[model samples]
Target: MRFGIGFVGFACLAASGAFAKGSIDIGRAVYVERTREGVRELEPATSLKAGDKVVLVVEWRAQSPDRRFTVQSAVPRDLAFQRAGSDAIEVSTDGGRNWGELGTLRIGSRLASAEDVTHLRLRVVGRQRGRMTFSAVVR
Candidate 1:
């Protein structure tokens, strides 16, 4: 299955328009682009493979920005969660129902690894292979 980055067409993350007087806006883009000093451009992803590393860049802008924000994204079952360097992440193992830190997560009595995470809550996010949607609110 394939997912679109700019709208609600795909089961992955849906990108919606700016909200509430347009003071704050959120945008989503998935790319296969790696962070390299020599790499000038990031390629957008049209499809995903088994072990592809995707960079999910969520853009947030506001006339007056808040000190903090809580961003949530819905993860597709096909993609496994990967670790980003941010410290403000809470992950869910049981769909989007419950969320916990990496150490606190479990699946049927086994502790969750960085690889077993399903959903990611953070300032920025990454994944293995699946559809995803991102949402954020200024705090």
Candidate 2:
């Protein structure tokens, strides 16, 4: 379940042109879920072990008026999603075909859990330029 050397390559980070008049840079880092003081942090990930938390960083810089756009990143098959930096994030468990909140999405008769998330879509509602992260675990 570890994120091997392959995970450090471009295949592990997905970037698309969903942003309008803007560009995004995506990268992966090891997620330090908590420390002795309960503070979270992110470290460069060279190799990751099973169950290790990984953070997908999506940073954008835009020069357009009303920087409204959507960005989507595909969750690498080697990882299971845990959470998103924004509370209003949407998830897609079936590739990128369908999207909804975890509580409303279903794989069958059961509700989808965070771990079932396959793709993450974030809507930058306004002219905000910053970084957004999604946490996942090495499967």
Question: Largest TM-score belongs to which candidate?
Answer: 2
Give me the candidate number with maximum lDDT: 2
C-alpha lDDT score of every prediction, in listed order: 0.53, 0.69
Model 2, span 13-115: residue lDDT tens: 4445544323543334444343446776666676777777777776765565365677677787887888888877788999989988889999889998988
Give me candidate 1's TM-score against the actual structure. Answer: 0.60
Which parts of model 2 are misplaced by more than 4 Å?
5-41
The residue-level lDDT of candidate 1 at 15 comes to 28
Candidate 1 scores a C-alpha RMSD against the true structure in Å of 8.8
lDDT of residue 12 for candidate 2: 34
Model 1 lDDT per residue over 1-139, tens place: 4433433222433223323445445666776544578864557777555555666655555445442334556655555556643556567777667788888877888898766665665542232112223322111
Per model, how many backbone clashes are there? 5, 0
In terms of lDDT, model 2 sits at 0.69
Instruction: Write down the TM-score of every candidate.
Output: 0.60, 0.77
